[model samples]
Target chain A: MFKRKLFHNAYGKTLPYLLLIPTFAVIILFIYWPAVSSFRMSLYKVSPFGNKTIYTGLSNFENLFKNPDYEKSAWFTLFYVSFTVIATIFLSFILALLLNQKVPGSRFYRTLIFSPYAVSPAISGTLWSFLLNPVVGHVNYFFMKAFNVQVLWLTTKPYALYALLFSSIWKALPFSIIFYIAALQNVSDELLESATIEGAGTLRKIWKIQFPLVSPITFYLVIMNIISSMFQSFAIIDVMTKGGPGGYTTTMMYRLFLDAFAYQKTGPASAQSVVMFLLMAGVTIVYFLFGERKVHYA
Target chain B: MMRRYKKPLVLAAEFVLLTAISLFFILPILWIVASALRPSGPLYTYANPLTLQTFFPTTVTFDNFVHIFKNLHFGRALLNSLLVAVATIAISVLICSMAGFGLAKFAFRGKNLFFFIVLITFMVPFESIVIPLFVLVKRLNIDNTYFALILPAAGNGLAIFLFRQFFSEVPTEILEAARIDGASWIRIFRKIILPLSIPAIVTVIVMVFMFQWNSLFWPLIATHSSRFEVVQVAITAHRSTEDTSWANLFSSAIAGSLPPVILFFFLQKYFVRGISGTGLKG
Candidate 1:
């Protein structure tokens, strides 16, 4: 094997290691070290500034479990992650199926729909907040013109979470659409044609052929949306709702952010991150075991 | 193309569905651009009535854009973000591609172990680790510096994966021939490998640039000074204050988002390929 490596006899004994050092150094310092530190810090009540610490053991976790806010955050995070995963997969699959129809102007539609993936969350939040503003906003303006009533999208309780849901789904649709479109395109023309020859209707063909072929991507997207909702929702919550009316939209990650950064409660924050890291790992493991088995090469 | 004969009505319905979905994606972007272009005023003036002018400024002005770059130091923020992204790309591309080449070509000690590390890191969401990373960054006394902002994200495991996949396909014959001709491995890499790896390099560049440009959380914690404020953080500033500056907010968000959008338009193919390449096989 060494003889058949890039150089005969594998002459460059140290070159590969040298090439790998920078990459390994970075992950060790930034990823692995921090991960281990997060596990460590959860056991100690570190001061906000990191200038003080006490060995508090599992008390921080006990406090986290006891905190009403943490409970609320966990509930919302569950709701948010579930809704986002299901909705994005369903909606973007529709968009992708439509785009895959070879519709006239499909290219134009594809370009516009997939453009949002390029948008930053900060900008997305700003635009959504502006559009969903209770007064003098287009959404309300149209609602008022059509229905004669105004809804407080940002300032109200249930509406704020729903508003976030809308914006986040809007932001996420393009990404999933891109993936689904790719997956749909990968489904073979021969199988589709055979289905057509067998008198299968579009819906029948989609349900039978397209759906199974794209299941892997759907599963992949489910994992992605969950990870995104769990950890990457800071800007959206920050700009649009500020986790607000009360803490209605605060996911556990946002709760952790607030505790660690805003409130200086480092121990509970570390515990929250530990939970997040495990949740993400668990989801990815499920994807590997289940979703990987569902892959259809054709 | 799998073009099947369908009723024109069905075709029309598909067209309508496609167009409606496209509008949902386009209108918000148009709203931001239009509202930013409108002459500075209270947002209600332009937004209240659903007229044609709601999405198209009656009097187009660059003043909002100018005002941000001039007064708000958005130019500096743009520079900072660009610097950080470029610095990251520069460092990331070299290291990841090197690791990619190394792993692709070498049957070395701990190869599988290193590959496992890369896979694990790639599988882990970077955002989930930010708090811990912040702790590490603070501990190292690099908090609130460029080092903190750029260092953590500089070595991307996915980019290495992409490069490894790409490099594996490259034939070993050329390198062996070059070695026989007295070419140093580094020289062979520069001459043979780098030139042949443009597509992989482009993919990594796009990947790194997008991540760096769009990141808000790490940058939020890693740096605090106004001087180090990135475009996303600067955009957040537009809304954080009690008196949210809608004009500046709209303007800076538009300006800040342009770089990645432009990259998407120009390198559309790579962007799509990068998406498809992420873990799941498309």
Candidate 2:
């Protein structure tokens, strides 16, 4: 009995580690090893074939800062992230509040809005590209018919970025809307009823009570929107304009792709990757530092 | 009397606002379907582009889809996409759920540390690591292979975390009872835990499948030839080619989106439950 019990205990003790081996192996191989390799690769000047390498130290990083295109890409990324994050969150918040108001056909409307969540960013960009086509786009048609202004939506400076921004905000809405709707529904009715009894106006009641109640979700969405706009918006930018109109809409991530694939500047590309990773790390640190404490647990 | 009148007015205003927003979301989707059906020509010479005619095709046809399948080779790309997504789902689900089960049911040193590492991995985005990942795949000579697409995406941290959360909620007493009955851990997991956790498994499957299906950047780097182009990458390649038919591009775009959209419609509940369960908000 003693031997059997010992054997059982031994199996139990080893089983978790055995199960964990595959996950750790993949993580190490794909994530951590790549991370280390990227850092190392950034310090070298890689050949055209990525086989021959020469040590370059921080010169690759220095050259990136010296390059005007990289600076422009960074600025564009900042602008895109801020615009998309704020616009998406604000629009979704308003939509969520209105959706929660017991409107007629709310269920149908909810499905309509959330359906876009299923569409990939690439497809969303295509759909938007059709809608904003310079020659035959409906929006431009409306512009011409109503305002007599012929606007270039996809191939113009500033306007191309706006087109990209529009699609980004459009696709980003469903996630925020879903969360906001859930948060709004979870807000206790008794609290709202008491506020109503106190003769609080509808907007006032929402701002003072419901808004604070859902602030945790709002905070969380803000961080996610920032990260998404920073990183995942690459698909939209790629599909919409390919960071075009003289690189007006080329965010850093897209620039990284252009450098590596288009120009074959692997060392600079890896350095740009390290820069993006640091930027992401900084955002995460800020979120934990400032955003987490503001999150109210229900 | 004032209250009765005011409520209806508010409802009417809300209705107008909602209709406008819903149109904003739905109109573009309608436009894609409309564009796919409408006969192609130069600009508005084909049809009135902005009117109800273009928004809803007067004469609908599947010519563009036929073109995509026959000429653009999107049919093969769609098959490749299916194979990649299925392989990713099969491998990721097995590994993640097994890890989840072990984390949930077992006790050992470094368990919390292992989970923390998973959490940290989740926080790292693929974009930041793509270069090195590409190099690694090339070094292994798996680039452009099915394993290239499948392996990188297989060990999903969020899925593991999700599975852990679900499995942890399974009562420990049941597993203890099984152990007392002399059932081995693997048998108990297969017989008791997995069957009971079907909902969670379904949720993970749908989530992983959607992710793999919709993936663009990695697949773009991983494969170079027409033999390995997934649907999303194929769409981009199609778009970039000069003289590619706009109608066919529109049709292919819609075709590519259909799988996930259809899946979402069928599995809407699981998507919602998965999002909320994974703590997307908090």
Candidate 3:
């Protein structure tokens, strides 16, 4: 702390603290306070009219558990998070591997591939919904021509969930690809040349050299993708499915949205938020605890 | 040896693989752009038959774009999004960089605790607490204003982390020399440090701008009126379950996505930097 005195004669002791004030003010007011209050808010009974509150501890959690729809939402969230995160990361890893091939026009290919990074999930839903429209969808048209079967995409159950999964993975793919490409670029040519000299083949090199070299980023993407899938699905579900075909696509985040915004179940929604916070924050915490230690690379 | 080992057939196969993957990513965007440029029609007219028309409109027109701006008030939505983004970037860069500067240049009591809080805020995704943040913002009577949309995001932990990481690398000798030259703290920061922080500033701007531009959920909840509607909200507005307006939707979606796409293209390297700047670099 003796280094603090180097510039202190001019900076004044309070300057740093003064500079930090706005950041703290915003973080406290917007993030931490709200997070802390959500736990407290989950416990109480809150009226929809914003006029009443009762300290009914744990009832909101009880009600959420009792609701079968909540159970389905939880199940869907599990699948959605797992599928979207894994598929996006895995597929993007392969795509990055392709781009890292230094193929002709790699720069153009990289730019085109990551363009969807700029598209909002809401807009992605619009684009995907248009692409997957039941009667006119090119995907369905191709299927029909190949197999002679009409497949309903957005209007059907399980298919709607599939739509959510597909678009979400597509929307989320570019982020992982960009990160993975960056990661892959860090794999040294010397290492790869040595591996090639040792008789390692293409797939083997990717699986062994490049993959392990990028595991830290893969882990980062895992945590980030898990967090994003929870929220980003909200927009897609809102636009493409609207949690439709008997709410098949409604994950916990979307369910929480509906309960809070549409149905005005503030208490239960708060409980759901608290539950999701614990689950997701638990992922982050575990990442810090173990994933960081295990995955740190040269 | 790595590039030489590939046979002509394998190289051709990799080339084909790259082409197919590129098409997979580009088709949806191309479809939207194609549809957006079309004159109004039955929503599915060119989408089927797997024809060339599916990829290109017969009569290319600016009518859909004109229609949304002329009738649907999409221009207002664009303005709203632009305003929010600018405000967010302005406030975010200032406060986040200031916090970053504080942490980087100073060693103070409670520094570890403060840094830990900043870390925790980012580690927790902002979307998780929307329900309660709504409550807090409502109580503060700012829920329906731009403040609600911009303020919460302005306190971005990632941006602050990025700036702190960057600022730590700046030589202390310059700061100390500037102080010795009788430059006050504010002058030192503005004259000496801010110019040196152009890269960090641009990265933060790009990060904040993209986050604000592409945001839907927070704006959807935090603000309620058409007066406060953002680009994402306006685009989604066309997708109502009842008779959906596909022309307006396509037009608005394309228009809304342009800013970030253009920004990414121009600042592609910084875009990569921002991604890596999120506390992970490979």
Candidate 4:
């Protein structure tokens, strides 16, 4: 009887482990293994024909710092991340407040604002590229007609980065709006009513009450914006500019692409990826450390 | 009465602002549709292009859509994308649901460790691992296959995490009653748990399907030829060396985006619920 009891207990314990097999296998084979391999590949030099592999200790990192293109890409990446995060969070907060107001047809407005989140980046990029085309774009025509200014949106080096930012923000804003809407809905109606009764005006109510209530969502949005700005913006850059008229908009990931696939410098590309990974991971960790304490669920 | 007047003014201002924002969002989409229908001759006119003449098609035609299918292999790309996306959803949902059930219901040793692994993976960006993943795929002889796309995406941490949260909220009494009735663990899961978990399951399916369908970079890297190219790649390949047929390209793009748009319209209630529910819990 004791033996049977022991057998049943052992079987029950093993069931969960059995269920976890598929997930563990996938993570091990794909995520964990590749992560290790990336670090290992950072230690070697790769050749064009994919034939040569020479062991290089820390040389790839040294080369990465020395390269001028790397510096430009790094600066561009930082600027892109900061600009997108700030603009997205600020705009989303305002939209959220507007949508939360007890106005007629507010539901329609909420849905319309969130609609852009459904469009894929590929479609968004295609549409924007068409709209911003210098020759026949409606945007160029409008600018010429209205402002009497013709800016070479994609072809010009100075203006190309802004075009990229414009397209990204247009695609990204809807998601931020959705996040803010969710956050805004959870704010206490009683608190707002009390604030109004206390003679607090609109801006002051927002500053004193709604802002603190949604501060956690703001923190979450900032972290997500940084991650996406770094990793996911490559698609827009790829489709719209192909990293440029002359690599003027070449981001770090774009440059990493050129290094690995185009130039066949796998070692340095791996090093660049590692640096990006570390930088993003550092940001996330810091955000969690300082930001988590301020995030109130209720 | 004065407060009532203030409310109408607020409502009118809100209406105007929303209309402007919606126009800004939808204008490009409208242009894509108009450009797709415009006669090929009128597409390249450089001046005064915003007039009603260019706003609507002179003669409606399906030539661009037809050309995309014939010249760009839109049919094959659609099939490839559908297969990859469906396969990813099936594999990920199965693995994640099982893992989630185990994590939620069972009190096993090292459960916290497993949960931590999932959390860490969630935080790590795919770009950080793409290089090594490329090498791994090539080494495994799976570089050009659908498996390359499907398997990696199937093991998504977010799906598992979301499922775990949802499952944990289910009442334990239901499962205990099933156990007392001599139902095996698998039987209980199939009959009692899964039936009750339909809402969560639908949420995961829609989210995973969208993510897989829109994925670009990994597919760009993993697959080489047009045979394996997905819809995004197909539209991209339509841009030729000398001149791009913007009409046909945008048309194909609009067509490619149609599935998710339609899916959203149908499943939006569940989608919103799932997002808000899991979002707050996280």
Candidate 5:
């Protein structure tokens, strides 16, 4: 009996760790190991065949910065992230607010609004490319008829980025809207009721009362949108513009992809990955710092 | 009197504005679907681009879908995608749920530290390590196989975190009762916890399924062979080859997008619930 009791005690102690092994094994092997390897690879110039690796510390970084197209790509990435994040948050916030009002056909509106959430980024890119293709695109067709303008929406500088931005926002908006509605549902209705009784108008009630309550969701969306626009929109860019008519729509993530595969510069691509990782981590840290203070004030 | 009159007018204005905005959101997606069914003719051959025909086809056919499925090897790509997604979902759910049960139901040394590590891993976006992951997969000799797609994404920290949050909420008394009945931990977990955690299981399944189904980047590079190509990557490949035909491109895009959209239609409640559960909280 004592031996059995000891066995039971030992099993109790070991079971949790035993359960954790598979998850941690995968996380360590695939996630952390790869992350560390990428950082190490950045410090070397790796051959395509993986047999030759010359350690050249910081030169890869220097070359990346010195390249002119890299400069434009970085700038366009920041520009693209800002536009899509802001547009998605703003537009989705409005939609969420309307949905929260329990307007007519709220369920219908929600189903429609959330449909884009399931669209693969590549497919979204494909659909938009079809819509905006200069020759057969109905958008261009309409523009020609209405304004007598034949704009190259995807093949021109700025316009290509704009088209990418539009599609990015369109795809991301559903997520933010759904998130905002969920957050809105948790807001205490009594506060809104009192605000209404105090004669706070619709705009005032939403802007002053509800917005502050849902600021956490706003902060969350900001972080998510930034990360997604930076990283996950790779497929969209690849499908729509293939990094552009003139490298105009190549974000940093897309640049890394091209450098890695198309250009076969693994080491430089690893360097690009390190830079992007740091940038993303830095942005998240700054946002959390600000969000903490904002939440405290709330 | 004036305020009362102003109220309805404001409501009317808001109704109109929201309806218009919803249309703005809906029309483009509708246009994609309509264009997919369009006959293989030039856009000019149809009615004006601004007309209802742009969004509602006057003449429709499934030839584009047939052409891609039969000619472009899309049926195989669809099968490959399903195999990957289903396999990933099965693996991640099992791995994550086991970890979640451990974290939620057991107290052990380093438990907090383990959870903290999981949380930290959650913040590390997959993009940063994707390049090296390709090399690692090649090193493991899994490149271009379903294993390449499945293994890397299987142990998702977010899924584990979500499941842990869920399992924590299951009443401890139930487990205690099972313990008193001399039921082993695994038996109790299988009999009591698993059955009770259906919502959580569904959430994880949907989340993982959508993610693997919609995934594009790694799949694009991981598999050079069409035999292993998933739908999203296949769509791009098909597009390049059939670049001239807007009809085929639209059809293929629609085909690639349909499964997840259809999945959403059936499982939207769980999707919304799962999304909300994972979303940020004050």
Candidate 6:
């Protein structure tokens, strides 16, 4: 009887494992297997027929680092990620705080603020490209009429990055605002009231009490912004500029696209991808190491 | 006495600032709509100013919409996107929810290892895996099929994680009672767990639907023919070729973006809850 009970108990405990098999199969087949293959491919050399898999012995990595285009792509990616994250966070924090107030039409305001989040990056990037068209764009038309300035928004060197940044921040701000609003709502009302009772001004209460409470959200937003800026902004660049005006906006992922698909340098592309993965993983690890301790849950 | 006025003044300032910001966000969308309707001369002419005339074309018609469908094969692409998205949502939700249920409610050895594996996959960006995935897809001879787009995206980490987090919140006693009453595991899932988890299931469906609908890169690489092209790829093709009509291009873009926006607006409460609830945990 004891042995029978033991067998039944073991079967009961193992049932969940049976249920998880499909998910594990998917991960192994799609994610883990691909990741492992990519890593292995990075170690070899691939050719056009795709038949020649010569062992490169770290030559791909050496080639990747040696190429000046890689440096340019890296710099552009850094600039894009940092600018978008900072601007999106700053603007969304202010918007979240403002919308959190008991103002009339607040619901409408919240919806309007979040409206952009629903639009896909591809569509939004196309729309913004049209809007920022140097010759026919409404933005330039208005500026030319008002200030008599026809700035080449997508062509000029430094301004090109700014245009991309503007488009990215516009797309990302609604998401950040939504997150911040949620985080702000979770802050204790008593904390804010006590700050007020201590003779604190609005700015003081926000700085001393509210900002600290929302730091975790801010950190998460930063990480998301970085990831999105790295991987997803390729669409924006593809649509808006095609990494154009002499490759001024050729981000790392875009360059990876060029190398693998356009240039047919599959081996180097795989190598670059591994490097990009390590960079992103390193950043995320650092973020978690420092930020995890500071995240306070109520 | 002065403090009362200060409050109203601050509120007025906030109102003004917020309205201006909202206008900034809304103007581009409004311009897209306006440009789509504007007449021939103003549509292509740089010098022509945006005016009340621009807002309403002199000959107001559905020329843009009709032209996109008639000229650009956008109808086919839209249909393809709808098929892929719906299939993705159905398959993903079912598979992920089952996995999530297992992870959340069941006590099994190696559970933490499996959960960590899911998390690692979640963190690894698709860009890292796209090449190998392409090679795999090619080897399997599934390239250019709808399966190329749907299958890889169906078992994503985000949906699994979202469902698991939600399933964990469900009470265990209910499942226990169902089991005691001689209900099978699959039966408990269907009758007890699923019925109680409709909110989360809807949330996963919407979220996964959005992701699949907007997906571009994988489809761009995987699919070879225009017939197999999703809406996003169609848009990119329209932009790249330049021979395609601008009115048609803009109209297709507008149409492609409308479904999600409308769905989100109608089901915004659930959408917002899903985002906030999932985002906080992440």
Fraction of native Cα-Cα interface contacts (under 8 Å, chains A and B) also present in model 2? 0.43
Off by over 4 Å in 6: A1-11, A48-50, A187-191, A296-298, B1-6, B39-42, B50-59, B71-73, B171-184, B187-199, B241-244, B279-282
What are the per-residue Cα lDDT tens digits for candidate 5 across B1-282? 122333677678777877787776788788878878987776456535577777888778998889888888888988999999999998998899999888777767887889867765655657668777888999999998999999999998778877886676667777777888899988988898788777677778877888888887789778888789898777666556444566766787788777887876877666556545532455
Instruction: Compose the digit string of candidate 2's lDDT tens values, residues B53-118.
Output: 767787888887888899889999999999998888888888888998877767678777887778
In Å, residue B51's CA in model 6 sits off its true spot by: 3.6
> How do the residues A146-220 of candidate 6 rate in per-residue lDDT, one tens digit apiece?
999998988888778878989999999988897788778878777777777778999988887888878867887
Q: What TM-score quantifies how close candidate 6 is to the native fold?
A: 0.89
Question: lDDT tens digits, residues A271-291, model 4?
Answer: 987787778667877887777
The DockQ values of the predictions, listed in order, are 0.52, 0.43, 0.52, 0.44, 0.45, 0.43
Off by over 4 Å in 5: A1-11, A47-50, A66-71, A145-147, A288-298, B1-11, B70-73, B101-113, B119-128, B168-183, B187-200
- Compared with the real two-chain complex, what DockQ does model 6 have? 0.43
Q: Give me the displacement of residue A166 in model 6, in angstroms.
A: 0.5
- Candidate 4's C-alpha runs over 4 A off are A1-12, A102-111, A188-191, A245-247, A296-298, B1-6, B52-55, B70-73, B104-108, B123-128, B131-135, B138-143, B168-200, B279-282
lDDT of 6 at A101: 85
For model 3, the superposed segments whose C-alpha errors exceed 4 Å read A1-16, A48-50, A155-157, A295-298, B1-6, B104-106, B123-144, B168-200, B224-227, B277-279
Candidate 4 per-residue C-alpha lDDT over B1-282 given as tens digits, one digit per residue, 9 for 90 to 100: 113245676678777887888777776766677777665554667225587655566677788888878876788988999999999989998999999888777777888899867766755557668877888889999999989889888887778877886777677777777788988988988998787777677778887888888888789999997778998778776667687777777788778877877776677666555544543332
Q: Report, to 2 decimal places, the DockQ of model 5.
A: 0.45
Native-structure RMSD, model 4: 4.8
Q: Candidate 2, B143: how far from true, in Å?
A: 3.3
Q: How far in Å is the alpha carbon of A157 misplaced in model 5?
A: 3.5
Off by over 4 Å in 2: A1-11, A47-50, A289-292, A296-298, B1-6, B46-49, B70-73, B101-108, B111-113, B123-128, B164-203, B224-227, B279-282
- Comparing to the true complex, what docking class would candidate 5 get? acceptable
Clashes of each: 0, 0, 0, 0, 0, 0
Residue A157, model 5, lDDT: 79
Give the root-mean-square deviation of each candidate in angstroms. 3.7, 4.9, 3.5, 4.8, 5.1, 4.6
